[model samples]
Target: MTNEASLGRVLEELGTTLLDVVCGDAKRSGDVGGVVIYDPLDEPELPANALVLGVGLHDPADLARVVTQLGAYGAAALVVRAPVAPDEELAAAARESGVAVLAFARGASWTHLAGMLRSLTADSGPDDAHTLGRIRSGDLFAVANSIAALLDAPVTIEDRNSRLVAFSSRQEATDPSRVQTILGRQVPEQYTRILEERGVFQAIYRSERPVFVAPLPVSDDAAQPPLPRTAIAVRAGDEILGTIWVIVPEPMSEERSQALYEAAQLVAMHMVWQRADADMERQLRAELVSTALQSGPGSLEAVRRLGLRDEPAVVLALTVVESAAEHALPAQLAAERKRLADAFAMHLTAAHPRAAAALIGDVAYGILPLLQEERAVLVATEFLARVGSRLRPLVGVGQLARDSSALARSRSGAERALRVLRSGSVSRQVALLDDVHVDALLIELADLVPRGDIPSGAVARIVAYDRENQTSLIETLRAWLDHFGDVAEASAAMYVHPNTFRYRLRRAAEVGRVDLKDADARLAAMLQLRLMKITDPGF
Candidate 1:
């Protein structure tokens, strides 16, 4: 087995000095060049078995170092061979080393040596996902199927150590369990004494051929399904990621095999893109969530940024709307916020329940930023129209909160408007927070005012005043009642003179046709005053 001349020449061709030539026989050690081997190829498997001693380096000094390391971790022996060399120093040192030294004068030929080294070197490739290209798992799945489709074969892509990941089907794609089982590794076949020894299923891995004969007896489905005669090892750059098993019912044409190879390549690239896209999408969603938490689109600041100062703005709740996941809640809020911002100048904010704006917790917080008074009312009506009788909505408008810091308070105002809407019996009624804020005192009194409680004549007179006088007499009358009808007190409270206040009272009496001094008239006057205090902003 020892042919130092031929072996040395082969090493010469490769021009590598990192060769460790160990020998079982001292006679074989004297003559060798750099990194020669003279030991028998058969040895105990001892890589991970020892703490170190990797690479199987061919240089004597490096080999010596490896031996020293393995010994420290309890290696049983050191094997060395002779390179065709005049390096007497290394050979002498090898003899003196204490470990069970196996020196070989004759071993496997250098022609064999040259070929074996190439195979051993395959796993040491520099391809790492962080340093080089790496396929994401999802991308690998997609590409695996694509490659199989192109090969005219059912291809199953498996990850390292032969775990099935994805595939194209030649047989039924259902029965996922069965499909996965048949994907990467084939079931072992039974053999008999009469049969010749079977070839290993993976033997073709040693060759450059695209397909390998599976070791077991596997038949094609329908007598014409694709073949599993060849498999291509998938690679991320130089590092092998996994293997793609191609099903060819029988041998495939060379052209078809080449096509399959190209398809495998495409699948690899596809997997890479899929990974990138999925990662990006996940990141985008994370950003959206952060945006929602910091402040949804309907925040006062958000509304201001919407840049609509003139449009009427009112906050309204969304009701009876369907939703998907809770994770999407913030996004929905942000979306509605933006929609309102665009349409209503971001005048809305998400409101809490028993507050205003329904589902602001589940769906949206609107900032109807720039809506006009009429437009805000219309928005309420439109919301009701969509919700139908299934739900009711309340709208409230306030002077826009100047900043996001004020949004929480503004939201309370919007809710109060909703309270006004719900507390009163009306469908799609809209109220303004400013009216609510300014009229809070009157609202308390109005709540005590009986419905349809205003005397008919009183109601008529009030209506007449609105039709005639440009000012809202409701607030004025409420103010008077609130001041206890003392002309002096009422006038001073209203920032008017006693005489002017008396004149307004006389006019009010004329409209009602009720005496200002009479007990029944006063009682009626108080009732009308209470109702008027809870004034409608439009008047």
Candidate 2:
């Protein structure tokens, strides 16, 4: 095995626990091959996987700046001793830069700490060698067992989200926290909240060392005493994958802590491997969804591959407004869009198991089985409700497709409805294609209408007369047609006297040279004017 130590082991040996983890808790699994004492005047010559800096860094701002620079140099972690506690700004910068921030106790010996770290880096134990070899052989269980045996403690491995991935087999020695985490496959939200208030997670994220958390007071009437725990971050480079937590009654010995740190490195390797496999699966699913959206010969085959071939389906589209996109950075916006898409897909899958959702560009598209048309509306409404006021996204639902062939048509209809929703005429969060059929139909036929085909002269003459005289002839005619040519109702709608409406109608007829007495002519005029509003850019 390689003779290397982690920052966590070094800190434990130096008798200093983590103060606050600004960022890079996941990266604490990295090996520490050397140590560097930082001098501000001189340029840093950091070695690979080197732990840098030491106590006597008094100013938080200056310390934060140095931490940032060390992060850029790819340092494993920053060791500092402050006269006063570091401020939040320093912690925030360290987090953003993915550098682990470790603060020693007040009046701690920097020289002794540095010398101890150097000596530790020069030694490697037989058990450590065995664990590292097992990790490389893809035996994560062996690594976990080794750490549990060495520390004589029950251990649990959890992903960054606190979801349990692996655990030691020492069930009898496990505490309530380990049992709860294993049973739920995640840390309980109540426990998570308590830890957050205590800054445990903050320390975990920023520290490249093991963080010891004391038991918290129980709120329940039959409250049980909390167990003490030692947790180390599992990381690959600057990317944190998970954490290895040991439930112990007291602090671990230096030898045991060092072994635990080595085990974390192995766990990080395992996590990286698992993530790579997951990424591959995600990419394949994205490709399948992309293929299903097309109308080519093999599109139905693609749908079959995703196991949604025979189900009645509809397409749903969600789009973020330009204003929201403008306010966020490109990277932040992209990440948000991805998060929304994943959330939508998860909800869709939960409701409709055969459904598929994907984010293509700024829009999120879903092809879900039409179990019930109302359910589609419910799903869309629920998604909007969950999003609430944060995104203010517009949603459009297409008509149901009875078969795969019509899937493309459903997608087209959804796009059409989305266009109408984007026009700002609808006040609701979701618009269905059926609800906007008239506008959709007019938009579809607008391109097919030939120039000067029918009633163009009458429409042009009426429009010119209204524009030149500042009158409302077109509005009156539209209202009359809408009310089925009811003169009294049209007059009421226009807020005009009956005789004034009649006079305007007559003038409209005279100016356009149209015979309003003919039902065919009246119907034609109404269709033309309505189509004009939809198709004409100036209108």
Candidate 3:
């Protein structure tokens, strides 16, 4: 009639007078879920919850070896026939291995006892069905909290990456690891390392059933029991979404363990729903970004829906330029690009909740909301750091657009900055539109200039003379104008004597058919030469 049975309950049902505890007296409260008869002739595959070893072997050494194997298999407790006196070797092995050791009374029927224990510990049909029903009702937190209350322990739900998603409210009895993990919402790297070293994560990934991990050895005191932990992978079909971690002070009762299993199923369902919702949200955001870039009539409305109304925002473009050696298969490259895009969106949203990001072609674009213009560079710097060195992306920050209507202009600026970076005009990791605006303007202007509109007269004649004679007349003219007609400075710049520089200048005026005495003509010639440098392809 009991919902579940423990080692003590099993022994009591068999009659306390029938068994003697030689060691592991402290672990009498351990739960007994199943019975396994040890056979030395065959390989033993022990279940994690509990194992009641029947007395088929009489040697003390063999009993010690079985106990060691059971402990290594994470068996809660082992039951065996009593010895004439306490076996010191068996006791020592049990203590060292942290496996509970129990002895039945001498001459007790092993077959009768194993049958009785198995029946007593059989799964509670109604209790399990009710627990599963509650789990399937879509209330994972409520079910998890109820389980915690039943077991008198704290519980944490984590994603496959070991990031904490939810945890029980019970914190009256907790460890540093629990506290830190809850505070950070993820397992710290150092604690993750410890778990990795203990093979706990590997076991979780490998096992279909619940995995039991011994408490971490944070303290060296043998008298203090380590914190016992249990994990069940949250799986939907073959895909594991996350895990359910239970911190147990004692072995879990069968009913509670069943509830944990059901909880994992519920967690998996919740994760599937959450991921679907996130995907929808991401798709919508990407559409919004794309629409804004297209400058559609609905773009302003979309921007407002994202919570950026009158607020100023900047467009940041991240161009992925992978090295030839880093090329991957098409499938792998696509997946990597998708991951990077997701990373960009997540980081941008974290920085500014209203920010929107999308991967458009090979570039990831983000419309980042900002309160002030001064923070643009700082935001760009932080973004680059977040991207890290792995991608080696070229980041371009556009000028801040004051309203949603100007978002397209901001995006254009970002694109122009990216183009400038690719053109080798700027050699930095991040290029801001404001920094490259002059070059961008000049480049645009140069493209717009008609071929016939190129400077003629004085500047054209000097260029023609330099090409025909293979002379430095144009160079002399540029140096003289750069020094504001300072003869001494111009001569020093050209590494020539002042008298020689003056002679070259006079020759330049003669070849160009310009009167050097007229200041207006001289200024006009300087302007012509500057425009030719930008607009003329030959220059």
Candidate 4:
């Protein structure tokens, strides 16, 4: 029911519940491109017609400056925290810039607001526009708004576990607890606890009719009394799908109650349709991403379908390093992979609407629509940081691909960088192709060498001498080379006296008939050691 063609549609959908127009015209003619958060310290490049959230800019003078700046960049609107009393300067800026100034509602979270805005503007095609009973399938916000219109009261659809799925507008008409629920997208534990104590949930689950709950007592002077709730369990045949909860001042009449009972049926159908459609979309997206990365005949078509046809982008490959101690079961590992892939997709989408991520085999690949390789590196690092150290994820970022056809090359670069990380040659969890180019090359070269080739030249002679005489010459040479000929550090690393290490180094040079001072000879020896898998484990 809502389109992103104008700022008016956003206002109409959200209403005065979560946002209020503080200044300028709400019916501005422009397509809302994307949602961006404003940071005074780091002024990010604003997308055209962007809805910028001025999270902490409250000072009138500062807000006025930002408003003009965003206007110059053609931002559709700027949202600051609520209670914005427009000064003369602020009002004049909004009028001259034609950038609508909106206020975020008190007690609502910026994350929730951003999420709602992004969902409204996400790119979609005809397949995603399919409808069930006039409401777009899988569009829960629209469904919630429709249900609210039917009941003439605010309502929320939640899962069996009491987690909020979708909620209607007019949330401000409810109590503080309801606002908190909307903000967190979940019922507070204290409220859920009270419901459990009173057997409210059990009653709703057990009955076929709507269960009416009386208002809860105020815990303290500051806490508002919770509004009464009328809840009905949504079901499909014998399986209970979820529940629809309406905030009412009192128990509803028979006709209104019947309306809610019937609404549950539609809600069940929509929920079922949403789940099926989501699964299909995920599978389709995975196929498209795979095709695009293959750089074959269908790659261009796949890229077009993915909305990344002419975009310069970067490819990122992510995987979990196996832990021997965990010895994770196959099923558990598969589930973990799916979970991480979904989270990765959500993270990338939130950062950039055009970004696409999907799990291809065991690795999750993400294509970020950005021309700057360094920014992609930063994005990957932030993702890893959010994932934390538990999964021990390694992300390999590739150079910028000029367009759809170049995606395969970027994917190759990413795979090579990932190979370096997986080979344990570097200790970092995230790296770009350029950062690990040498290590990646060495790994590739090792693959070309035959398994039985072993070490050659001076290194081979030293290895033979060490084997026959049980000497420390080979260790001494490796240590000296690894430490860049720093005798004290090399000796310390080998846990031997500096003079002893020096003696062994001289002996190794003599036995191998190699000149230690020759740079070319040292490079040859190092290459041989690398190819022999002596400097690192097998690639």
Candidate 4 C-alpha lDDT tens digits along 1-539: 23434688778667777789999777888678888777675555666888988877899899999999988988889999989999999989999998989998887767668777876665544655777768776667678888899889998998877777778888878998787777776788998899899898889989888889898766678567778989999998888888999998888899999989888888898889877876787899999999998888999888888766567989999887765356666776777777778767766765665688889888899998887888888878877776633456788998899988889999999999998888877889888999999988998888787776768778889999998998879879988998999999999999999999999999999999999899999998878876666344742
Local distance difference test, each candidate:
0.43, 0.70, 0.69, 0.82
TM-score of 3: 0.52
Residue 81 displacement (Å), model 4: 4.2
- Which one wins on TM-score? 4
lDDT (tens digit, per residue) of candidate 1 on 77-161: 3433444342444444444442233332233233223222321221221333222124323434335445655665555665555
Q: Which candidate do you rate higher for TM-score, 3 or 4?
A: 4
Q: Is candidate 2 or candidate 3 better by lDDT?
A: 2
lDDT of 3 by residue, 243-321 (tens): 8888876656777778777767767776676566556666777787888866678987777766566567888887765
Q: Model 1, which residues run further than 4 Å from truth? A: 1-149, 161-165, 173-209, 213-229, 296-539
Of the two candidates 3 and 4, the one with more favorable lDDT, higher being better, is 4
**1 versus 2: better lDDT goes to:** 2
**RMSD to native, candidate 3:** 22.2
Instruction: Between candidates 1 and 3, name the one with more favorable lDDT.
Output: 3
Question: How good is model 4 by TM-score?
Answer: 0.79
Quick one: ranking by TM-score, best first? 4, 2, 3, 1
Give each model's clash number: 65, 7, 0, 0
Runs off by more than 4 Å, candidate 3? 1-151, 218-226, 319-354, 369-372, 385-389, 419-427, 438-539
